[model samples]
Target: MPETTIKGPVLVTGGTGFLGSHMVDALLEQGVAVRCLVRKTSNLRWLPEDKIELAYGEITDRASLDRAMVGIKSVVHSAAITMTEDHDEYYRVNETGTKDLVKAAMNHAPDLDRFLLVSSLTAAGPTSRDYARTEEDREEPTSLYGKSKLAGERALQKINPPFDWTIVRPGAIYGPRDPALMKLYGMVEKGSVVRVRGPSQLVSLIHVSDLVEGLIEALTNPIAVGKLYHQAHPEPITWDDVADYCAEALGKRTTKISVPRTLLPAVAKGAGLWASINRRQNPLAKDRLDDLLQ
Candidate 1:
């Protein structure tokens, strides 16, 4: 790790989230003081309150963000709503919230050394070309979530600021404590046969630990400033391999049943309906199924 003068305290917007918490841990390991901006209702169970400064705020509230950005030299903007009560809420939180943060950061911390945006690979859209997508590829987001995230990336680029900005687009991030991968883990643990849709689909992924290192590298590296980088493990694994690995990790047999592409839409619709009736969010929403099928 490159050493630097303690310019000012770093602020992480979603410091309590899985990725955000891991980033915070990495920053603390580097002996950097962190100030976390979290909403009043957001869960803070993963964070150590005594060791870091806590700023009570929400991304949707500009005034709250303005207050949080004070004395902060750098920011890791990660407070995005993945699943929401309403579909349009994704745009409100992901796109508009990002613009608000960029404006606030420029206003309060114009001399900020680094502004790292934790964006998803989904922003680059679907790829059936059997290759890992790079930063040079054109963004053709297929879903509302992807479009919103891509919009946020565009918003950040359009910002007129003097600070160094880097966008880290991470592929499907998975590791211990990842709620997004919990459903797959549960299925593997229950000895349930996993169904692979588009078994030949090649997708890139990165362990959360490796992703943290990439984020830290982008913080001060001049090559990363004003550039978008795709962060993933060197190997791109097939969907079937992902299932097999998860099963092997859980000490279970991977009896993979391949689901036909034609039947996926119906299955996803049924899953969505079941989740709606049960008042629970389904990870296998239509867009997610589409992503898998692609």
Candidate 2:
């Protein structure tokens, strides 16, 4: 396929974040001008300060979104709250914020080529290796995060913008700059790995690099417009498989300790309570636990 010509700079929301930062790097390597939409307080450690233009703003703020959309050819919307104690925050940022962004683009970026949404597999709900999911399947999100993302997808469809729009739903993503997966690797490095006893849990994951390439294609490819795509490895891997890989990579002999499934809710609840009290995210929140066990 011939390369799609992008005229103006591509505007990326959440460019300072893990996935977004990787996207920025890829775009820069392709010699496309990049602009990042970021909050005033967002950390710039991951972003290439000297390379990309920074557009200061929050996605929820219409005015800021408008300012960011000016003269931009395409948008990569990767800004959404992944973990928060408040359930409303998911809708506020993911659903409503997305709606606001598309509205801004429609009003401001008359020449916009495309708007690409970085969504999650959770939005499509649970699936097994036996029954893989397809875009044709009904989205039955199991968590608030998933529901919000699905809602975000709907928001784009509802607006029916003249410009192209695509949604890429990636499964459990793990790579550099992902602190959550790092914790598991850390545990494995310590010579002990924890697992939930019962049925083997399966997950589809794609490396950040591969996912980024798909995202860029979804953004630039005219055929992908108005379509939703699932991006992940073809085969699913179990949590045990992941732990074993981590152990082997670190050259460490690790012990696998299984925890009772029945006790997880309590532990998750405690973690949620503790995180809530301390104004932090609960990595093992009940909603996330539901996703794991589902």
Candidate 3:
């Protein structure tokens, strides 16, 4: 993090995602050349084509990853999916995908030194309202996605490839061009706010810039190697706090509604059933909803 501790030509797996695009820009700003791995049909509007090299690959496909691994010295794996009703899909992408990527790195990119895995705070599960979660905490993930991410971390640790690997767990990353925050702000614009009630009274949030800085630290800091770090703002912000802030900023009174916690599991199940009957993606899987409640 201290003025170019990491070298150039880094490969980012999820270049098209909101956070991934911010990372690409941050790396490029430091004069580190970046290569983005994305599918053929991926939208390139977030970043310009001239600033980065493109490697067409999917994490589920080993051969494609192998092709992308060539000549890449450091890897910042940011590719992941957050939406879907199926646990199998989450396992396949978040868990198995990480395994395949690490395997490919071991087999193909022998020269690769710094491997950074971008995980989530959900992997650590919920903490008491007054406590801050730490890396030493045992992983009791609330959602299937969290479980898969924790599994990925375990896989990387077990593999223990001949390289300096670091795992980073970020919390509630929000910033420009983020759709979820946009929706929240839009709700604020309309003088309405909604959030799920949870067991924990506090929430952790880190802006995209701060999250990207932590990621760069993971890449450059020698102490970060072989360690797991939780990268989140120290301050705690709750759902009500977010709503109140938006309302105060916009000079409008806000109507805040907290959904009843008891209905979440049933709603999730009903949504799953509806999705199956309609052959569509479920908005919230039961496991995910349960995680939210926690």
Candidate 4:
């Protein structure tokens, strides 16, 4: 198939983030003019120094979004916070921020061909079976992050004078630049015993490259419009197996140690408390203990 000509520049929010940076690279490689909207405080080391446009804006500010949308025909709404102590912060950035972008896209880029929202597999909640999740499943997010994303998805659907919208819910995305996965890799590299909170629980995952490909495909494919898609690498690996993969990647043996499920709550609770007291954010909050066991 001939490549779809992106008639105008492409706008990428959260362009300094892990997945967003990859998406920016992918768009640039496709010979598409990329415009990145990022906060003033965001680190731009991952982004190229040339060949793209930059717009300083935060998701919370609706007024500045119009500047980013100018001359952009495709909007990849990747701006979102994954972890936060306040649930309201998640809603503000993930839901309200998304709504603002969609509205801005409609007003500024009236002829926009696509608006892609990068979401997460957590939107589907924790599944009992090991099978890969599909787009048809009901969204029952188990965490504030997931819940806020689902809310964003719902808000996007209600946009007036609608543009083509595709929601891609990716599983645990892992790659070189991923902060969370890198921590696991670091632990394994240090020969630390990796504890498996739930040894038998299976979770889906995708490489950052694969996910970027999916996002680009969704942008041009009419089938993706007004649809939600779940993405993985066609395989689901357990948490224990993930540690083993990291060990193998690092040329080390897996230090598999099973932590009892009963103790996970206490551990998570303590971690949460420590994070709270330190005014730090912990992704592994108490609510995650149950999902960890699955």
Q: Write the per-residue lDDT of candidate 1 for residues 43-121, one digit (tens) a residue.
A: 8898988889999988889999899988898898887876544678788888999999989988887667888899888
Clashing pairs in 1: none
RMSD of each: 2.3, 1.4, 2.4, 2.3
User: Cα miss at 63, model 3 (Å)?
Assistant: 0.6
What is the C-alpha local distance difference test score of each model?
A: 0.81, 0.88, 0.84, 0.81
Assess the local accuracy of residue 67 in candidate 2 as a C-alpha lDDT between 0 and 100: 95
Error of 3 at 161 (Å): 0.7
Best by lDDT: 2
Estimate, for each residue in 42-153, the C-alpha lDDT of model 3 and write its tens digit.
9899987898899998999999999998888899999987768666888888888898999888888878879999999999997667677788877788788888889888
RMSD of 2: 1.4
True-vs-predicted CA distance for residue 134, candidate 4, Å: 1.8
TM-score between candidate 1 and the true structure: 0.90
Question: What lDDT does candidate 3 reach at residue 54?
Answer: 94
Q: lDDT, candidate 3, residue 237?
A: 76
Clashes of each: 0, 0, 0, 1
TM-score per prediction, in order, is 0.90, 0.96, 0.91, 0.90
Residues 199-233, model 2: lDDT tens digits? 77998889998999898778677788789999999
216 in model 3: Cα distance from truth in Å?
A: 0.7
Top candidate (TM-score):
2
> What's the C-alpha lDDT at position 292 in model 1?
55
